[model samples]
Target: MIGGIVGIDQDIVKADVTPQVDTANTDISTNYIATSNDYGKIGGENGSDWTIDSNGVLRIQSGTWNDESVAKFWSSLKSDDGSNINAGNKITSVIFEGNIITGNSLASLFDSLENLKSVTVALGAKFDTSKTEDFQNMFSNDSSLESIDMHMFNWENVTSSLSMFYQTGLKSVDMTNINAPKLSDASSMFYNCKSLKSAKFDGTNFSKDGVKLPQFLASCSDLADVSLQNSFTGKITDTSLMFDGDINLEDLDVSSMNLSSDTKTSFMFQTSNNVQDIRRKSITLPADPNITNSKIDEYNTDRYKGWSSNLSGDIVPSLETYYSNNANVGKTTWTLVEKDKSQYKVNYIDQDGNLIETKNESGIIGNPINTTKILGYSDPKNSESQPDLMSIADNNDQEFNIVLKKLAPYKVKIDVEYGDGHPSESFSVDIPYGLTSSSAQVDQSILDKLASNDSLDLDKSKAFIQRIASGNPATEGDGFSLSTVISGFNIDGSDFKSIFNGTIDFVNEQVDSAILEGASGQTFDAFEIYFDKYEQSESHNNGGSTVSKEITDINQKSATFGDKETKLYNSNGVLIPNIQLAKNSDWKNDKQMILDGTKYYRVSTDAWVKASDVYVYTDNISKIRVHADNRSRIIRPNGDLSDRALEKSTEWKTDRYTTINGEKYYRVSTEGFVKASEVSEYK
Candidate 1:
């Protein structure tokens, strides 16, 4: 009467029954009990030992069981109280701890155990059957066993699995870790396991050749999932009635099965009508001449039924064309048969082969590719003809390329600047391709200023821009401008016209300051205008010494050297040798000349200076009176004072003036000049 909790528990003694020992057991150092009311012996004499607790838990501790029918031994067991006991009903669980349980077979090991529910191989121990070759009926007829932890089982040497879990109450079985490379039989392995909902064998190794699998999962009416992914690597000899009554299976993937020419596949999927999807690597029908197309049709119509078929590998005779030759033969209607479409991507690239955008597409073999136009871009080669079809016959990802060039013009920024830190006027214009200014609407004021300076060569500056726009090499300083200058641009180093399309700041360094005009904020400058006029001097006979009185020109300009010392130039606008002017020096000039777009003032008969380097004032002085000291000594051309002097309090007519040591000297006589300190204006 084994009515209690069904697991391992300590046997609390209400009473004790003496253990009986056989006379054949000679080892007195250990208590080798043959039978008892509290426990029973599992291992034979000279083998290992076991015990059954009051909770009906059989604990086999550190031992081996001789290869024999363990179920039959349990049916005929007797207790040490000299009474017959039903071990099957009393044993509810078996716990193996610390040892080897080897045998030639595991057939009927736990068969028909009406109350057996669990078998646990403890951690740090294994149920080793390394020498066994059979697993027939291993857990057969165990209608109460819902699960088994066989993770620690060593089944490397097994060769058969016939009816292994037949008619069991297994809800799920994960034999993913099983490795039986020599196994050849799994017939009826889980046959009639009506409660099995899932059986996973993802990593199991069943590599034996010509393996038999007839009725493997037949009659499993509740079977919903059976995963055998990549578990088969052999030629199957038989698959008849493999899933005969598995009406709940929705999808079956036998893609790994290798059906040889001599294989038997009769009723392989009999009554599995719920399955809608079937996948296989390819179809390899038997090579026997007697097995005709009619035979295969019968199998599909009466046994293996599938709603859709997904097959891989190339078909020598297409599935539809093969049946076309045999119009009399009836074939199953495969509602959907297809191969996965190959995926590819089209990359839109710039002229320099830089990727801009990508489009992903998919199609079957020989399908033409279509493309769309991108704004502001066009293919230079006009090679935008329809691209080649999807030539790759397999379902692999690939890529293609289409190069495009920009069609829109570059927006260049035009800036008018003054070198004297004045606010710059900026605007943007659409410069055409090739970096040309043909489409540019330059400010008329800027162009007018550029032409106003006779020293500025407008043709040369326009030519410089033309060189860059025509794809010729050009540098920033190569071009000149009176009102606007281009800076920070390099044509050779830029890729894809990037530098040309960016900001092009036109800076006018010539105009240091400007005045706003007409309230439009657009200013213009007329920097130092030059004229072609000449001056004359008259000689007056003073004491018969040919005293040439310098005649004043009403248009004469009074020029003063800038704060910074500057060099004097010849009349031809060339720098005078060793003629540097002191700062704040003053000179009177009536003539001007234009050179390199800059105006120059003629300080002497043969010397000139840039107008930009000095400040000019209107000269209206015509006569001067000598100081009362009367000692107005005359200065020689070599800068020495002469013995001659002007009469005291006498007025004289003068016109020319010169700078000496930054002092003003006026011409009182043609022979020498008088210091400005000794002269006063004659009103």
Candidate 2:
């Protein structure tokens, strides 16, 4: 009776159950919220340190506002039962007045402050979550907490995290400075986080040592532009209905995933189907031939009986720029060609179009290129669970097509894998039907010209193939018929010792996404573009057969944690705790970072002021509240505490700074003084 479609012609009905109000309700107020001790902090040793004024502003009068429970500050007139008053819940805001929270898991300490709407951690305070794990129910069902700035909290070793933020009203979360190497169970961790708008989880957040992640962010329906590959790099054995209800996830990349142990993935993507494109052809089995995972077949049968997996291994490389930049998407290629008599080398180009050296081709060559070395080989099928990278043909069409498969959003990716173990025969191009080309260049140039013309007429495409097949004339007098020229390949694969394969990626509007057709009337995402760079199949011997050593390569960003240093390098790039190393003598020269713009640098690695000793003045005013109740005192210009004590109402004005015995002090006025650690810095 509570949920259904609210049609345009329907008038919505509501239940009018009114709640009772108190006769003497002070809730209707123009005053602010102050120290209520609403959380039963009364009769304690430091009891009178905090108090609220008539204007409702809760202010800390003295002492560190340190506490184990933040909710103790909340209370309303209705819950003040003879000093049993509740704290934090009734108060909409609180002033820290300067308190250093040395407690753990401040995420959970605010568990009782469900009504707390805003909190500001003043300077000189630090919150640590270095060893916290169970943030479950930490902010569970806290509907009133709209924002919690966690930029300053440290989360170094958080582990078990079940329902950490179940049903909270957070609009955004700051997951900065987090390190959860031992994280295991995170089921429903952000379950149904309906209001979570954006997230900033980096690669380290999902490293190894964590357990399987299932239903972790299951129903985070409002999330978009998320990279599942970026947020979770741990094992995922059971992904059953993991994202069954996420209705707004736009793109997902699960490429090169290790599903060797994944036995059950039923309904994992049942309802998360409204996507633009899947990133990669997810591996069912790995590339290894020795191992086979049988569970994948059962999962496929049980999970995809009705719904389609939109995941695939077939690719369509774009040839639209075949005449221009030779921009191919899959694994990139490096070839070697000859400019007339000069053997000009062909450099490899990355996916980003940057020219990279041939494998082991740069720097000093320790040894000569070994022709006896068998670099690598390729096959139609590598593993039972993995996709067939060479499944490009549709019902055995002999002639290579100009047209591509019409899978929108998903373009073809040719995986230009590095390292050898591939047969060059697995990657050869078919000579056009009528062309008897002794020259690989003439044969390839003709093909590239036709492929670049997207709207090439079908009959003309057929004629070109037939002309090359039966030996139609481009003219025999042409000079392309040499014994061997450039072999069509721009860069030779043997130099880099690379392999070739294909993958699936989104239709990149940034590079090329043009679709073309072949002589068989079938269309594809790409035509045989890069293959034309190779010589006619009779040049170089690949696998005992005369095939050019044409190849491709794509740079894969290695997933392993590459950085081992965890020390925080501050503005000056100086490593703290190594302060003694900064002792400069007449022998050591000091380096200076250019004082341009707003750059920060460390003058001496050994120099640093204590946090308690540092304070900044605002608008020419550096005043502090008098919290010394009965022990108020004055100090002389000579930096000595006066024998005569001052009244409690006197305010101290800070003027300048000085270091006495390595301890910093600020002059509140001409002769006034207060230890920096004893009073809060006024903003």
Candidate 3:
């Protein structure tokens, strides 16, 4: 079937006589075989007879059918008027009935039948195939025929079944009972049976000596399952191209078959690498050591054949050595690939061994690593520089730490303005990078640096630094300056660096003068650092108690001082230096306390004075009159005086009041407080 041979002998003579049959009914089954006169075959035995019934069933009844007689059976069919008809195309079914014996060559018995659909041995039939030797093209190329039931067939003497069912439309085959002990060649037995889905030959033995099975099931494209059990027990000589193109065959086990010493297994699995499991039980190499060693060398070097043998046991020591040297004897070679870059992480660990940050990147081997600088991190030794990249090890678990050090605060020059008309001086103070909030106090080291400078004559005891509030300091008071005197010299350089160009204000006070009084009705600004000269030493009396009580009733009321510039005193009745209240100036008072046999009231955050210097009111005043020309000043929340002053003889509206050193102060703005001694109610 593979080479398109029709398998008919060319020497057969043609027949001239036609059998008598009805012309109207042209179906081949409705006609019968020719009589003695009508038959014209020139060779073979005459015992076999062919007949067709109305159902298109062709029966070979009780006779011996040889190759030539069977070929003549094709020419014996006729119509009613003795016209030749194609029995191969018209016959729908074939049955071997009664006692029958086939000759040595039963090849091409029903080959190339166009419409033939079925073939079967009838019940109670004694069909014999013990004498048949060549079944080369039997039943080959019958495209429309789907199946056959030949369970009674005994293939005990079949020598060569080459192309027996080639190119047929068979869906499956069961040759388990068809044992061919003498069968040697089965090349192309089921080749190109494209529609065949499965086959079973598990019982059929192919153990005969020197068995040749080339192209046994090659090119069965649709074949999926093939079962074999005791079929391959004998010594196999030639198995080249045995399963050449059975692409859909997934598993094949020829492990039971012991290959002869001179077996030709070249390309046995050619173009069939998809068969995942192939078991070779025990393979015996050639008896000659040179040939066996040469074949072993070829197996090791053969690149054209992609199959790998699963040879479990080797009869020769050379093959055993080869199998032992290569554990994956049939597997492909190893391939190299690049490593993944995402898995290598560079951890930035601090000096305390804490993981501060991490970076994921892979560097090329033997090349300098590319790195970036973190904002506030650096090498421990250098605040301005980062760690060298080459120093970090290149490994997945490598801890790449440069001993991450926090960057030192950089120095920024700020202009210090002394509100006492001194020339503003510039000093450098540290401002850390990426600072979040305002610092509570300037670093003491910065103050020490300023104190050591020879250009500025600042009293280290009185000198303090802080940020200013507005662009015009005289109107808006100080910036967060209450945190300085109430706490320490605080710095909020965030907005000040851009808005005020790093400018700070410093005011000098006359702390040595005693009773520094203002003119009559002269309103004064609340003092910043009210007791700049007093250190609150242990020598000062506490009047039997250290803690002061809250005077909630008259806490925010106004107090009118005496006509003379009222003198202020401390909690111990000691006269305070450089501070006094103007005569008749209305002041707001807060807390009142008795100390050292004298009653004093606190008018600011730190300042307190004798209660006799002012007359405290029961109710808070809404307006205050400025009596001093330019002495009236606005004080910060921390009791520091700002540069602003109230106009003389001007009446200012007051929202609320608080007491500082027994002198009441009224709130004229957000944080500016004017002392009651500097202002009185305008009438």
Name the candidate that leads on lDDT. Answer: 1
What is the Å distance of residue 295 in model 1 from its true position? 10
State the lDDT of candidate 2 residue by residue for 47-133, as single tens digits: 334554443334432333233443322333244345543444554543444333233233354454555555544344333445454
lDDT of 3 by residue, 196-219 (tens): 767776666754675787777777
Q: How many residue pairs clash per model?
A: 2, 67, 30
lDDT measured at residue 382 in model 2 versus the true structure, 0 to 100: 23
Cα lDDT tens digits for candidate 1, 1-683: 11111222221211112112222332222322233323445545434466556667665656666766554455466676877677666778766655656667767777777778877665555567787778888778878888765454556777888888889888777777466777889899889988887787766666466678889888888776777766665667787788777766645555445544466767775654443322121223221211222122212221222224323233222333444443433222233223334567778888777888796655444445545444345532354433553253454467778776655533333343333344544444443222212212222223323223233222222223432332222334344332232234432211111222222222111111111001111121211212122122334454555543232222346444333667788744567887777765667776655544456767778787776676543333455767553457777433667788777668676655555433567665443667777677532
RMSD of each: 41.9, 32.2, 43.1
What lDDT would each prediction earn against the true structure?
0.52, 0.34, 0.50
Report the error of model 3 at residue 325, Å.
6.4
